[model samples]
Target: MAETALHNTTTSWSSDFKEITKMRLAISVVFSSVAGYFLGATVLDFVDVLLLAIGGYLMVGASNAYNQVIEKDLDALMDRTKNRPLPAKRMSVQMALFIATAFAISGVAVLYYINPKTAMFGALSILLYVLVYTPLKTKTPLAVFVGAFPGAIPFMLGWVAATNEFGIEPGTLFMIQFFWQFPHFWAIGWWLFDDYKKGGFAMLPTGKRDTKTAIQVILYTFWTVLISLVPAFGMTGRLYLTPIAAVIIGLLGVFMMYYAIMLYKKRTPKSAKQLMFASVSYITLLQIIYVLDKFIR
Candidate 1:
């Protein structure tokens, strides 16, 4: 009976750790990093892929842990985040802080061993996300813009890790992901606007889920589509996106834009939720298209 009880407690503890890490979101971020590495690397060996996964996870996990620590009280006030490890007391603040610091140090150290530029980029991402973006959210809506700066780094981090240098390809990778964040977060803000309000977070540009916010989503959506096609124009060097791939990726962007328009026109929570999900699908599919296009062409 004691062993059984211990097993249950251990499972619960593991679950809380996963929750603190925001595993799903971190995995996607890491995936984009791996994709970027695959694109920029001449070989894309197993070791590079393993390192990207480890480094990306620790970096993002550390950010999530620190974010939860900083927002513990605010998180308790929100329906979506109230049961989080920090807020619910599943993990003490000291424990979370220790874990966050350890993860961050390990993440940066690993990347430094891989390459200095990649390590510096990882350090920058953690500092920006935890130090800048976390505190800035409640202070100003402009935080989203600043937050995107670090949020957009992972996709390019992979490339720099492989090449050990910065180049136009990584820059282009960064640009596509950078522009994609506005509409993505705006849709999330629309759906969770009330929850954000409860926490005093001005996540939306207008601080309201109305026409103005929807228009901003559409504008960003347009930019995302346009910039995604730029690689097809022969400007991306050996990274040509090809005519068919560009057309298909362009159509996918159109689908995302259509949902944005629907949200703007309808101006309802349901429409916003739909757009939010669509944006996830759009970016994930867009990334897949990009990776596949490399093989196809």
Candidate 2:
């Protein structure tokens, strides 16, 4: 009976760890960094790539854990986040903080082994997310703008890890992801407006779902589509996209924009959710297209 109880406890703790760290979200963030690494690497080193993935995941996990710690009360108020480890009372704040601190230290150390710049950016991402963006979430709608800086870092962080330098290529990569977030997050904000209101989060640009917010989404989607095509014009140095790939990417952007337009026309939570999904698909496919075009073309 004691052995069985021990096994159950172990399983529960494992599940709590996954929830606290937001494992799937951390993995997706790691994917962006790895894709950037592949794009920047002239010759691939699997070891470095592995380290990048591990370090990147650890850093993102740490950021998420810290975020939950800070927002424990607010998280408990939201339907979407109420069941998270801290908010659900499955884990104590001290335990979460310990895990976050360990992950942050280990993540930075691993990244430093790659290069100082990569480590610097990783540390900066955590600071910006926790110190700046997290606090601003309830204060102003511009929090999304602030959050974009950290959110966009992973893609360019991968490039920096590979090249150990900052240049137009990584800058272009950063810009693409930076602009992409406005639309992506706004869709989520729109869809979950009520849930966010419960937590007093100023997520939507206008702080409510309306014409102005929809217009901003359309405008940002347009800019994201335009910026994504910039590399195809041979302006971003090593990050140039081919003509065919540009066409495909352009089409994908248009596909996402179509959903954005639908959200504007329909102005419903259902449409907002569709736009959110489209944005995710767009970004993932865009990364795959960029990586494939580099290798194949």
Candidate 3:
């Protein structure tokens, strides 16, 4: 009985850790950074790439864990967040803080070993997410605007990690992801507007999923699609995309924009949800396309 109880406790603890850290989101963030690394790497350093992945995941996970700690009370008020480790009481605040500190320190240390610039950006991303974005969520709708800075860092961080320099290539990558976040996040904000209101989170630009919000989503989606094709113009230094690859990406962007347009026209939760998924697909597939384009052509 004692051994069985111990095993059960261990399993529960693992589950709570995943919940508190949002491991899936952390991994996805790491994926973006890895894709950036591959695109920017002149010579493939597989070992360093692995280190970046570990460090990126740890830093992102730490940010997520810390966010949960700060928003424990607010999280309890929303259906989507109520079952998180902190709100569900599966993990104590002290434990969460300890985990956050461990991840943050170790992640930064590993990244510093890779390059100081990489480490600096990693630390900055965490600081901005925890200090700036978290607190601003309930304060104003502009929080999304503020949050986009750190949110877009991973795409550029990979380039910095590989090249240990900031240039047009990384800047272009940053701009692409920077513009992409608006429609992506706003679609989620549109669908979850009511749930966010329950927690007093003014996530949407207009604080409601109405015509204005939908129009903003459509406009941003257009901008995002346009910026995504910028590298194909051979203006972004090391980040050139062949015209064939450009056409493929353009088609994908149009597909994404089509969903965004549907959301604008219908302005329903269902449409918002479709746009949200479409946005995710757009970014993920876009990253893959960029990487493949680099090697194939």
lDDT of each: 0.91, 0.96, 0.93
For the record, the alpha-carbon RMSD of candidate 1 to the native fold, in angstroms, is: 0.9
TM-score of 2: 0.98
Q: For model 1, how many clashes?
A: 0
**Cα deviation of 141 in candidate 1 (Å)?**
0.6
Q: Write the per-residue lDDT of candidate 2 for residues 1-297, one digit (tens) a residue.
A: 999999999999999999999999899899999999999998899999999999999999999999999999999999999998898998999999999999999999999999999999999999999999999999999999999999999999989999999999999999999999999999999999999999999999999899999999999999999999999998899998999999999999999999999999999999999999999999999999999999998
TM-score of 3: 0.98
Model 3, position 218, has a per-residue lDDT of 85
Q: Report residue 235 deviation for candidate 1 (angstroms).
A: 1.0
Provide TM-scores for the models.
0.98, 0.98, 0.98
Instruction: Estimate, for each residue in 35-84, the C-alpha lDDT of model 1 and write its tens digit.
Output: 88878888768787898789999999999999999999999999999999
Model 2 segments beyond 4 Å from truth?
Answer: 1-4
Which of the two candidates, 1 or 2, achieves a greater lDDT against the reference?
2
Give the range of the ten consecutive residues with the poorest summed lDDT in model 3. 206-215
The alpha-carbon deviation from the true structure for residue 272 of candidate 3, after best TM-score superposition, in angstroms, is: 0.6
Candidate 3 Cα lDDT to native: 0.93
